[model samples]
Target: MPRTPTLSFDRGTLILHPPPRGKSWMDYATWDDRVEKFRIPAIQYRQVVEALQAEGSYFSDEAKAFEPLELSPSMEMEPYPHQSEALAAWKLAGRRGVVVLPTAAGKTYLAQLAMQATPRSTLIVVPTLDLMHQWYAHLTAAFPDVEVGLLGGGSRDRTPILVSTYDSAAIHAEALGNRYALLIFDECHHLPTDFNRVIAEYAIAPYRLGLTATPERTDGKHSDLNLLIGQEIYRKTAADLAGKALAEHEVVQIKVKLSQHERDRYNQLIQTRNDFLREAKISLGSLKGWQLFVQASARSAAGRRAMIAHRQAKEIALGTDGKIRILADLLAEHYPERTLIFTADNATVYRISQEFLIPAITHQTPVKERHEVLTKFREGEYKTLIASHVLNEGVDVPAARIAIILSGTGSAREYIQRLGRVLRKGKDKDKFALMYEVVAEDTSEERTSVRRRGVKRSEERGARSEGKVTQLEILPTKQITYGSGDRTSQRAAESSGKWDDNNSLETEE
Candidate 1:
């Protein structure tokens, strides 16, 4: 049972229904006294609030009469042509589907348009607390008459528009699923595997729209989402959306030579991973090992340890001072201007935050604090902020003028999400975005980078093949292989999708 915290409403003397534990003489009676200084321990206040909602405790004559606030006529902001087109697509796509547009393309505006178009009780799932604020503010501003409730890591309310975090929504999905008429999943790509998807299953909202810059998964599968949310109706690339409201950007692939010491540590970690992969393969013959490996890596301490080794090794190669130096160049050149630095680990985030004397945000940061920090960042109070993997997917930080990726989780989904940070439209310039990836030379970082680029390059090709987006130019197919101990060049990387087996390791087959 949740012990209600002592809350002050400035108006009538309001008292929480159920008082906290350790209640002595006065907390015993169920009195309606308004003004009294009291303490309700904060430890499990959420539990108390959740229990109140679960028990239907908040329903009352006065509670129901609080009349929802409404938006003024002057609050309406017209959508751009593309935004209007996206709205048309959303309506035409029937009920449930996902929209792939670059960051800063006014997806929230589109959602608002949908709300007005359909005008049903809607539930918006956000990934972070800051987004909860962003969603509530926009919805409230757009629909001043209606109330917007927020349910994130902590806050949980149910107004006309219920904005929630994905994690919390999934946890109590059985309840939230039935309540809303429409479900709008913002930053939809972050939903990975069955953990989060289970919420979508319970939802009966005939209307569903998912928003993402990159809809593909890190594992390179869109089929799961294609099943839950319908086919991606309108797909717009960052390059396609750039130079308008969004930024036109350049990606600089900064290669850093690893120090011998770091190289030695990285090499050892790779050997362990490769060795484990081999053992798992031998144990589960053919390609069944991949499933077992994934399962093992999913829950076991051993698997987690191995995964850490993989990331730590990659980070050593990727986040070295040499790599940081390259990233620093981007940050320094644009210093005094807003910048976002992303890394694979909290340690690296902390290191950069301390080195530059800037603020940092991670999952470990308190939810309340995150909202404040993001607000400050948006107001340009902080010029630079570094984040561990938390900012990779869904949260929106509007003032990120430049982005630096010193280290990454090696997820193509994550890569695209990190890149999405700076693509939001800016007012000062033609909205230029600078994406810097500091990769260590001659290591798996190079391999990972190639594979990641290849995935995007391939998807763009796939999109072209599907007759959606056309390639700027197509060159004649060509392949070149040098003599012994030489190299090979392939014209198109679309074929790289399949990994060659049989003699994949043969020097000369």
Candidate 2:
């Protein structure tokens, strides 16, 4: 009798023995509303893999297996009975939905518990590459035996369980959609947009899950999430997450008066612009004239540079520098093992990192280097790290004893991401610290915050509304039952029983 072998795709579909791969998976595989996502055939995957391996790629089959860092179930994970109950609820929800637990409420741990309870072909999608690696490390530890693959940071694998960056999955949505039985979106609020909507539309995996500290969308398309991806199933706010499994933190809003010199400079610009508008008869009516006047002020290269400098100077006068000093002092006072400070601009992050004795992290960081920096920070080699937007959303930093948001809130998305930074729970008493928002008296940014925060509040209230429906994502109901030993080991063992041998790794198409 001929022995049949199992086959899988980027999406995690299993065939007892699929026919020899045919077309490039991109043609019929897409599920775009306007233009569908692409799908590649199994033969395409095999060819790509072989080609990359021939080139001696880093992720090739020739690459030796990474040493396993196994986690004992008793040591790191002890799912609270309540958390387990939520997992049970999640299972009953058909494994499709979002869990909105407040900052520091142990949401990552919740995800871990869910993984343990409903282990299957899962893909955890995160917003940043830092998070991509963070998830990879954590999931690898949780299910050490599973042949988990990574799809961002220049690495891709065909393992049953995978962790990927939002951009990577979104970019390759058509090719990867049909491969997974389960999909988990972290910082799920960022979904249903340019980065995630495509993924939602293409992949037909039966199970889905999204997690966020704040589930409100920045682009005003959460309803799209409701329609496209899944529903917001459960929510627990920071006020609630605190004192539960999370830390009890304080928020300090420090306001700094603009320096006299900077105030005069600001006044000059405002006055000049105002006078030009009046003289040019462009009092918000003549759009062309208004643009011309502003352009005239920016005529000289020096003036143009000065205009930018003025804004930066005003920003420093208003908050960032003063806030930096304050942060340094606070870090000294608390000496938190892991503290993260966020800035709206990259320059601000750089200046703070240079001036203060803290490390900075951003998207520009190579994936592996970022891993080393964070690992060092986590193990207490460093006490503080500065971030520009990157740290605001998805990378799990359970060691973040304190978080300081020195700037931003332009969009509700910004606010949510910044606040979510400190929410990962630590050991001990789970004490958490969060210092958020510094406004310049009556700046437009302040007004925007009110609107965004209000909208967030409203949406939360509607969660109990029967008329207004929230999204609930379906997760795979079928658990990875009848498997023993570690996940990675099990997969390696499965390799011996399967049709493919030493061909588990995936290559780019």
Candidate 3:
């Protein structure tokens, strides 16, 4: 009598003993000389099963440890038109792909709908602890009967529905490879990193859903999401849903000039850096060129001086006195409404916070303190807040009507995220959100503003472009107010009931 073929999970890979006699299984298997058997990656479990079924091969599937789930959302509400369309597209694509919807456009609700449609053991991977907790709260409220556990931030409960951070998931990917039948990646753009990619590669989940406002990465690794999750089955920009799912918005650019003394020092620093670049035959025009400059800057004294000169020049451009003066004017102008001030560095964040007496948040802020600050901001206690890159992604920022960008990077993704902080609609449906970009005249900051808008310097003032901006003709309405509080807090208060139409779980990411 011949022995039956057996399949099992080991660490993050699949093991097949007795050597299944078929081309389908052989294609994914490698001969393990030491184990005297064939080994396959866990990711190929679905493909291998399908191929074996087609070939009429018999094998015991002992690798899958997850079971079916009977989940029904406790809340009763209708999804937005875009959410409906995105969900339909994901279903049509065999329930495996990415959905690109702007923040506050209800990507979380769409994920809930997908969960109901599939009803399988699921694991959700987020980029931050704040998001992990938010998802845990939302999921627990949506499914009061289901067991929703967490696998990050010091807790490691293994329920049918799990929410985990990227770091935690990556570290334990091997043990979790076969536990979930469905995987959902929030802010899935983070999935393509070398360390996080293994989380997806090791999982045997056949169904996947990736959600993000911006999917492009500065490193160009976003392309890896195609193979890691699925192709982008559906996408909608903030401009695409403006005035319907989001508040109507406008972007205003203000250019300020440095004082005579500041300009002289800026010129001297820029000249030093320029001379070094010229001598080294290096350019900062492209990513490669910038990388080469960084490599060259670490080799000698001249390189170190050049690096210092570049830093001083950037600081002057990003934090000039003129920009500070303009910021004061804008804050006073938009003082009646909630405002968020964004800067490129923490030093400038502290400077503006202390000078203006506004509350600030940086990476150095304690988690409990950060939560309190955001709570106060949401309750209308603090009308203005300043922050560095800490609030750019993963934090659940309350809805604001005005955003002032003092300085930032050249990444379009960052620009989109900052813009999204103010796009959520509140009690006033007619109100239009405003984003003011204060750029230093004749400085590198001006070029960064243009680059971040996803346009060339010549096209900075051109008509609205895709994924960049929306042109609204409506005038700003008088001080928009959240009736009781921001939509996030309202949803948190009424977690067991229906969600408000104007707001869903809107994270910065």
Top-scoring candidate (lDDT): 3
**Candidate 3 whole-model C-alpha lDDT, 0 to 1:** 0.81
What's the lDDT for all of these models? 0.63, 0.56, 0.81
TM-score of 2: 0.64
Clashing pairs in 1: 2-48, 13-34, 69-145, 70-144, 70-145, 71-144, 71-145, 247-431
Root-mean-square deviation of each candidate, in angstroms?
A: 13.3, 17.8, 10.1
Clash count, predicted structure 1: 8
Candidate 3 stretches greater than 4 Å from native: 426-428, 459-509
Q: Each model's number of backbone clashes?
A: 8, 34, 0
Runs of candidate 1 exceeding 4 Å displacement: 1-74, 152-156, 171-179, 190-195, 218-227, 264-312, 454-509
Candidate 3 per-residue lDDT, tens place, 283-337, comes to: 6766666677778989989998988888887888889887787888788887768
Write the residue-wise lDDT of candidate 1 on 362-457 in tens digits.
989887787788778889898888898888765776668788877664455566667778887756556666777766655555445544443433
Q: Supply candidate 2's per-residue lDDT for 401.
A: 69
* Residue 428 accuracy (lDDT) in model 1: 59
Give one digit per residue, the lDDT tens place, for model 2 in 31-98: 32332233333323333344434554323121111122333343275666557766776788767777
